[model samples]
Target: MRVQGTPDELVTILRETVVSLVRRDGPDLSARQLGVFLTVYLGPGPHTVRGLAASLNVSKPAITRGLDRLGEFDLVQRKIDPADRRSVLAQRTKRGAALLREISAAMADAATPQENATAPTNSQLARSV
Candidate 1:
């Protein structure tokens, strides 16, 4: 679908999507955690804590803390890079993929307007007359 919107409309869609996510019964991720999760899942592979910190312009400890939170929910996992044992690679999990699907669904739903809620139906207008 062609998605053309003003800045305000875009913000409204974002707000609705976030509200839907917040209401769902699942792992609640902070902004930082979500950022890290998205980066690990969407970005190129061979991701490390130091690399993520550099990509996000944050400290290594901050990335580590976000990874710890994501790990608790099993959204991400860390493994030692065999090529370089000293470096740890961040990997995506099935649960994380599922969450991304849910997020996409929520955004689609939010983008589709609910006509019933936004306007009065013909039957209601007739009854009032």
Candidate 2:
């Protein structure tokens, strides 16, 4: 079922997804790092530290710090722009794509209602009789 895009519902989903991520055996990304990761993966790439800083409304140093954390997870990589020696580009990795898929699954699970939790079972019915 599709989730209603209410603010409360959205916050619940975010909370659930974050909890799932934390419970799993994976890198725990900070808010800034996650933001950088999402932007690089979700948005059109060829992304640079300067461009990310501008798009994210953060400083270049902040973007670099975020990228440094992401790089440790192998979620993102930085390479010199071939045409421009002065520029460095953030590149996507296979691991990063897999992590994105995991996040999507977590969000999907968060959005879906746990019907079994609220549904009455035959055992409960017998007990009530």
Candidate 3:
């Protein structure tokens, strides 16, 4: 029998795919964790922990924990904010960029055929990353 639900209905499937793909090449990360990492890596300008938390719609302590994990993996670095000695900015290390590239490529690959089958091309995924 064929499944009846729309592809959008399979939230867990999508989440698992992205999580598994990321963990395959790098540290294990939840969806939220990955989102936080991406925000710091791809976000414009230097990002404070508070700013990242705000952007992610999460609490500061959550952001701090995520950053602490990323730092432990050596994927992110904490630098003294030049404008504010008491504050710090989270920067993506080269290792982090490489991992991001790998994850992006995997996500792009997983998305392309499905997207192309329904649309003219995969430009949305391309532009997203």
Candidate 4:
């Protein structure tokens, strides 16, 4: 469906969807973890920790921490870059793909109107944002 709203409005809807989702079903993630996860899952891969850090403007240690959490959830895997034994690559997992699909579906549901979507209030989303 066509998303009919200002960008901020659309963002509000999406923020609410995410809050409801986490409250109802969790694999609750911090902002940092979510950012790293999205970058790896959405961006071109054979993703390296250094690349993620530079792209996200975070430190290698921070990326490693987030990756560790994602790894605990089986949402990402760190593999030795076969071409370079000294470096490791971050790869998406089946579970991570499933989570992304779930998020897409949630965004769709949030965008739909007259659907009785259950989520936090706009104020809550605004505060969080």
Candidate 5:
């Protein structure tokens, strides 16, 4: 993200990111779901179910279940793999990309000390965390 800061500053940034997400009513993604989603979006993908299972140290069915939730949110799409017809490929979606942008924006907002009354400061965010 090119976000430069010390460990404590980064901690403050992360804390603020959480508060910003909650304050802005962002999607509440489970760690597993977020993992799958981020892997698809951030990493090189044409990603297969088997690959995801291995990479995440999770079961194929668990990945499938997480994909179901992500698909419901329009965050991911499952397609029959062209090269390996037997496999399924997990692909990203526009909505998912938009959500990432939303998160990044919130994090950026968080980095700048909150001036508004509704948004919490880093200390308040730390307490919540």
Candidate 6:
């Protein structure tokens, strides 16, 4: 079946498809939780809960709660800072890396057709470095 739509429509469809795929492959993660995970994972090395909360403009409690959830899923690990006993750092686990790979593959697959067909792909939405 041929799908006829504007570029915007296709972009939206591709975004939704990728989002759905990520959600399906990974444990049930809310948008907020996913955002938290990405922010922590992509942030500077050895991210502390307080640092993440500051970076995300959220409360420390919220960050802790989100980290707790990620911990429950075994996607993130919390370690007490050796230098500072009072500080805790959150790091992504192997499972989290694997999940990220799955999401990247799903997103790439969703964009492949339009990208190869000379149409702008969802990757275009990503800001160039």
**Judged by lDDT, which candidate is best?**
2
* RMSD after Cα superposition, model 3: 9.7
- The global Cα lDDT (0 to 1) of model 5 is 0.83
Q: What is the C-alpha RMSD of each candidate to the true structure, in Å?
A: 7.5, 7.7, 9.7, 4.0, 3.8, 8.5
Off by over 4 Å in 2: 1-3, 116-129
Q: Give the whole-model CA lDDT for all candidates, comma-separated.
A: 0.88, 0.91, 0.75, 0.86, 0.83, 0.78
CA lDDT of 32 in candidate 5? 96
lDDT for residue 100 in candidate 4, whole number 0-100: 87
Ranking by TM-score: 2, 1, 4, 5, 6, 3
Worst ten in a row by lDDT for model 4: 114-123
How many clashing residue pairs are found in candidate 2?
0
What TM-score against the true fold does each predicted structure earn?
A: 0.84, 0.86, 0.72, 0.81, 0.76, 0.72
Looking at model 6, report the run of 10 residues with the lowest lDDT sum. 112-121
Tens-digit lDDT string for candidate 3 (1-129): 464444543443455467657568557876667787889888795989889988988998998888888888888899999899999899989989888887767655554445334432234445877
lDDT of 6 at 49: 84
Q: Per-residue lDDT for 24-55 in model 6, tens only?
A: 84587766777788887777778898888888
- Residue 52 error for model 2, in Å? 0.6
| Residues 1-129, model 4: lDDT tens digits | 585787666777777678766976658888899899999989988799999999999999999999999999898999999999998899999999998888778777767775665556566777999
Q: What is the alpha-carbon lDDT of model 1 when measured against the actual structure?
A: 0.88
Candidate 1 segments whose C-alpha is farther than 4 A from its true place: 1-3, 116-129
lDDT of 1 at 91: 96
For residues 1-129, could you state the per-residue lDDT of candidate 1 as single tens digits?
677876556666787889999999998889899899989988998899999999999999999999999999999999999999999999999999999999999999977877775534444555889
Task: Report the number of the highest-TM-score candidate.
Answer: 2
RMSD of 2: 7.7
Quote the positional error of residue 57 for candidate 1 in Å: 1.1
> Candidate 4: where is the Cα deviation over 4 Å?
1-4, 115-129
Relative to the unseen true structure, what is the C-alpha lDDT of residue 63 in candidate 4, on a scale of 0 to 100? 97
Candidate 5 residue lDDT tens string, 6-102: 6666876776777666676556778799889988898887789889999899999999999999999899999999898999999989999998898
